[model samples]
Target: MDTQQNTALTRALAEIPGPLPARGVIHIAIPHTDRFTVVGNHLAQHPDLSCTAVGIAVRIQSLPQGVEVGIKALAARCREGEKRIAAALRELEAFGYLQRVRDRLPSGRTITRTVFCNQPTALLRPRQTASPRRPAVAATHQAPGPAPGPGPAEELTAAPAPAPDPAPDPAPTPPSPSPSPSPSPEPDMPEPPPVPPPPSFVTPLPPLFVPLVPPPTAPKPPPPPLPRPAEPTPELDRAATALLSDLRHHAPQFTLSEADIRHLAPGVAAWLERAAHPDAIRRTLTTDLPHPLRRPALLLKHRLTALLPPPLPGVHDLAAPARPRVTVTPFQTCDGCDRVFRSPTPGHCRDCREHRAHRAHRGDDTRTAAA
Candidate 1:
């Protein structure tokens, strides 16, 4: 490989993100025409060989053709005078550009492979088609060429053309008439007999009284008793106590009163003990407490009470507020009298305003005299 080209290729490969894998680097050096040409061209333009060195190193390790150089050999070749070849190799390996393949015998030497660390080039176009004219020429030469035919005009007149036939006219056709037939008398059939009506009853029947009976009553099912949760054990109480104590003692800026600690100690201790033995702690805290007290007790002891901090003094008891800050607005100072006024309007300060008015009055007197 051309050293400069190879170096440039290496630099280009390094510019590409990711380390070159050993197998991949060996594959790059496998003398594939397209890859070799692409890599060679890339190296020609940019010769920083860090990427190439990594790839070369990887290839040298894995492939039979590789020099089987240890880290020292690679460093001597690529990073001469550098502190450590192993360090450079490690950096390359981290980049995914170099990989160790095997160690050399007895010398504690390592072989590494360098591979191109790049995304595969997606070919945008397929190879061009072979020329058709060459194949045609070959075919014609192999078998003798066909005999030359007559010129265009002679070939056209060689066969006499047939005469054209006359066209027929299209017209709608009239409908054909049907044959007449004689009428005949139809035979009559007998009608069905009518149904007879029932005779009316003269005597009235006595009214019947039916007695009402009540439906059999079903026994109502007894209301299902409410489900009661299992009671919490002593271990849960101890674990809870220890956890709360730890929180109060170790947490920043937190203080618990003696009364509050005493009230909560049993539960906290139970909680800690249970935490040490998780299997013993009840799944639900409300399981042990009476139904009426369960919710209120949890709210007061666990959540609301634990979060309470020592009372702070009211805002009114603090020191009085400081005066609001004020910024001085810049104003123009009179050049003639040194009087400052809050106006940026040009020539309008007290001195300049009076000076301009006097000049105008003088000019008016001069005009009056001239008139």
Candidate 2:
């Protein structure tokens, strides 16, 4: 495959987000092609194969290329018994979905590695037998090539004499007499009437089709346009890529994609447009990160978003809410009514406030009652 097509296919396959590092996207993702699907489907639906076997084959196919998945590992991953996994592996191998190769390590240790070809191919498998050889051509004996010259004649040539013939005839004998004819039988009393022909059968009408339930049909939508992978500006690409690379260096286990970088490019671009130093942005993103982060891209994105500067000050719109002004004020608590109020005059609350008129009225009322 050409570079562009292969890259696009890889990205599409990688879209299936994997479990561990990614959806089996290590440094590169395995291309999911028809061949892979065919092998998986064969194992899944073949009557002789059990569901456990199908599940094992499918999970192995799901793994990325270069993954070291052994029978034990597979059993653990699939939650199947080790023996079951071994049997499934054998079945897969027998069915051509798997192949085992013995590779000798540098230390001379030979270990068997599996190669899986999921295509439904009819391979010309060879056998140990002698090849039938071609038949030997029959030898042709040429009749003695025409005698040199006609030769060899007899001594005398005498004319042969003819012989005469003689014969005679005889008389005939009388024929024997014929027997007399027998009497004829009497005719039947009355002849029977001829039988009428049967009536012709009419053609039958075809049966009208009636279904138990209406066939379900869904409205089909117009075909969606083929995906055109976005091409980001070179500078944005470099910045985003560099950030992801640095993060990887900090945390090796972290998995990130070019798509993720492109997705976060706008935020990075926003920071860049606001005259934020690229170094400052990088420093802010990489700073104070947890040791083992589940998703580094998410954390980086959040930091970049927080670091983004707001648009420069502009003339306020009339419809927009105005910004409130701020002024410092002292708070004091009223002695009579233990209520705190912010103001210049704050002896007490107005209702429980200290006033001269109410005190005199209270004293006169008390004195009148006493007299």
Candidate 3:
């Protein structure tokens, strides 16, 4: 009974044929009401970010505050090793999704602070050069000068001539010699020289908003055109189309529809016009068909276009030295039969010559008989 059941199962499996269809990722989303962390599409769908980096980012965002999220900590929590975790963290930092800063505490200990941003674009920080201290200007000091002496007017008021005696003195008092003028105050110290402004030390800052994606580079050059025959004709086109349609008969793998045949006909026509044999074209299109062949017309079109042969060579293309032209034989009339024939010089026709030879042989026979 077990043997019979096994045979039945084998037969059932044999009935199913052909390759299985390719499977692709399919999302079966279930909306979460609570205990879910909201992640922006910028980090989730970043083109440059790797899958590991995105996963690490999501995990870091979901965790509560005060949790150790360093490389070793993450490696312990997740299956990845420390090296991969560190690499992912670097990727996150580069794209502005995460930032790690070494902060110093009041107690003189330094610790790393990891900052995760859900929306890097909205909270993106601009990169700026550090601000340097401005240069100091030296102070200018001038030597002090002597103070100005009392002016002539102040001296007159300060020492009023001994008040004139109420009664006129009998003898004029010898006029006191006028006090010598006080020495002129020394020249005012020369004004101090002006000081120049300090040189600018602060570097100019780049644009405030940092782009999450790197700046675009120049576009690449377009590819060269595909090979093809120089000139095409209606007959060539028809023949090419027929060949393409008939491909399915010889090789079932290249079963193309009418639309595909029409589309690929021009490329085939190019191959045909280049003197490629029909059998060669068929073999080329059918040879080594890929297993589970899909889009046979596309494959045939590519081969036809890319593998087209060069045009047949002309007489001038020969490598040998040029040869002299052969002289044409002129038409001639046979001397005996007057039949027209071509020859370099006048001569009897072939039939007339053969008749003469036969008559000469018969005469010799007659002569021998008579003797």
Candidate 4:
């Protein structure tokens, strides 16, 4: 087998954000097990979760610890669709293999975090009646950041309570200097070099070009979908009718509406266009079909689509046409020594011509007997 080149895997590995210098790698023992022995075998007992979900769960659990990742990224890594990833995540969470928490930061940004907890589900837990085993899993919680303003002790002494009422000032109060408090420091700061104005003669060009014509102020509504092929073309309609006729002949009990036949016609017409025999398609639809078909027309459509034949040899390649059979040519045999020759008059072959020459030579040599 050719070596597997995981370009997607390599790209994902390259995309993993590196750890900060302040943080070092920490190893936490992750529960690892054969899916067939544990997950697949057990999940198989319940049909709803299907065998596929087990593999998807395993892919999610395979990510490294402490990597902040997104569902899209996980979907890409697992080569699964987003919906499938989401469903698998839900399934794992339901089974106790995952936990999700949503948190809001002080800045009002909300973030969702996922933890892969491989703890066994209650159904998978071993049952022992004797004595309860000490719970292996301990609840984990993050230490809360120091609560906002001040400690209870500091609140008493932090600041004296503001005066209950202040007399109205007659004049507009001067702006407080407390916020800046560093006018002297400003004097010590270095100044920027002044830019000289453009030479007086130079006229500035009109502000570049007028602000690019802002895209049409209003958005254009999406174009309506192309009208569906005018409900099947004439050829398709004809093919559909022909199919119904054939079905009626084979199984007089079968009945189908024009719409149903038209719906299936596209596939049947496609088969004919590809040079599939109409009789074969008809037989497929009408013959020893399964006993309890829910929708025969739809089933026949699927079969036609799936069983499309490979292109015929001359369907393409018109330059070189095929012959049904080899052409025959007439030939005659020599009377002297029955050998076939293309020249009918000189029937004898080249060898027979040489034999005649030898016979003439033999007669010439018998001088006394016949000369």
Name the candidate, 1 or 2, with the larger lDDT value: 2
TM-score winner between candidates 3 and 4: 3
What Cα-based lDDT does every candidate model obtain?
Answer: 0.47, 0.63, 0.78, 0.62
Q: Once model 4 is optimally superposed onto the true structure by TM-score, how far is the C-alpha of residue 32 displaced, in angstroms?
A: 34
Please give the lDDT score at residue 371 for candidate 3: 100
Models 1 onward score TM values of 0.18, 0.23, 0.36, 0.27
Clashing residue pairs found in predicted model 4: none
Displacement of residue 112 (Cα, Å) in model 3 is 26
Top candidate by TM-score? 3
Report the error of model 1 at residue 220, Å: 58
Q: Write model 2 residue lDDT over 205-259, tens digit each, in one string.
A: 3322222222223246664331211443677556756766566565564457878
- Evaluated against the true structure, the overall lDDT of model 2 is 0.63
Task: For candidate 1, write residues 1-371 as lDDT tens digits.
Answer: 54446676676667665666667442233345542322333332324335544455444444444454565566666645344555444544443334444457678876545443331122222334343332222221233479888999998889878897887875867876776665543444444454344444434433221112211222466643322113456655455555444443433222445555456555444334323232232223323445444233333355323432233446786868889998775687776677878764533587687888999999999999999
What's model 4's lDDT at 183?
A: 42
- Candidate 1 matches the true fold with a TM-score of 0.18
Candidate order by decreasing TM-score: 3, 4, 2, 1
Of the candidates numbered 1 and 2, which has the greater TM-score value?
2
Please identify model 1 stretches exceeding 4 Å from their true place.
Answer: 1-98, 103-108, 111-116, 120-242, 253-371
- Tens-place lDDT per residue, model 3, 18-122, is 543468643335579999998888888888788999999999999999899999999999999999898888777777777777799999999989877777665
Q: What is the C-alpha RMSD of each candidate to the true structure, in Å?
A: 47.6, 27.5, 26.5, 28.1
In order of listing, the candidates' clash counts read 44, 2, 0, 0
In angstroms, give how far residue 83 of model 2 lies from its true place.
Answer: 1.8
Candidate 2 residue pairs in clash (backbone atoms < 3 Å): 18-22, 18-23
